[model samples]
Target: MLPTATGRIERLTLPETDQTVCGRIALVFPRTPVAAAENPPAQDLVRVGEVRRICGAQLRNWGLERFDDSVRLLLSELVTNAIQHGSGSQVGVRLSHTPVEVRIEVRSGPVNTLTARDPGLLDEDGRGLLLVDALADAWGVDDAGWVWCVIATAAHGA
Candidate 1:
């Protein structure tokens, strides 16, 4: 069975040059603002797992199950970061893949600072980006506050 999206999924229109790509799925998550509260409720965290399931299903549907584990982990980290730290009310996750690589992009409100830090061994957090850096072939934050990563699948012989 296919996983369901917590928000909504839309099919994106790629350029002519991207027609060879197997598939693409875009998910939009709207941050549920609390009434006179400063932070989102704990329930919001559920979206993280939902997104992972959606990502895995999409990969399987594309005949790219080999990437399900890494892709889902990467998607989880990025989506978690966006939900926890982003100031924007909406978060967007875009997944697209070519014959050799899969691209994941997470976008939210404008952030003046975006960086990965080395945390102490005892620290429980701050390792999200580190995981992304280690697993992704390439990753960066765009001027528009979009955090994007590319995981090359050539090593998988796909």
Candidate 2:
């Protein structure tokens, strides 16, 4: 659990994982904080915001701020699905990047059946993976329920 800005204690459970990406490590955090978990209606948005804050900082620290907006959107969609449909108690987010690409992985359980379905123009839902597909250079879900994506970067020669 972590203390919030208001000094209230928030429940956050981050179970450790041994997974690593391209020699970079994985960071874990709870899918939802105390208030978000208790409040179902606002759970996904609030929790995704919290996760975005963490991810934004990581990108800034890595000198990859150029990808922030896309990463944030991708994180929101991916994490939302993880919280809504995943079977795990916590969600794991991992970020790693090389000179030419940045990778993101969101894992919730040992298994997930995520697929992008075609949605009508007026449909109100089912566009998450489609957005991921459009923004990410490459993306796929692994057997261990990890939805990962890679975005090409122009940092190669920088």
The clash count of every prediction, one per candidate, is 0, 0
Indicate the residue-level lDDT of 78 in model 2: 86
The 10 consecutive residues of candidate 1 with the worst lDDT sum are 1-10
Residue pairs in candidate 1 whose N, alpha carbon or C atoms collide under 3 angstroms:
none
Residue-level lDDT of model 2, residues 116-140, one tens digit each, is: 9899999987899999999999999
- Model 1's C-alpha root-mean-square deviation from the true structure amounts to 4.7
Ten residues in sequence with the least summed lDDT for candidate 2 = 1-10
- lDDT against true structure, model 1: 0.79
Off by over 4 Å in 2: 1-25, 31-41, 154-158
TM-score of 2: 0.73
Give one digit per residue, the lDDT tens place, for model 1 in 22-51.
677777766654443355566667878888
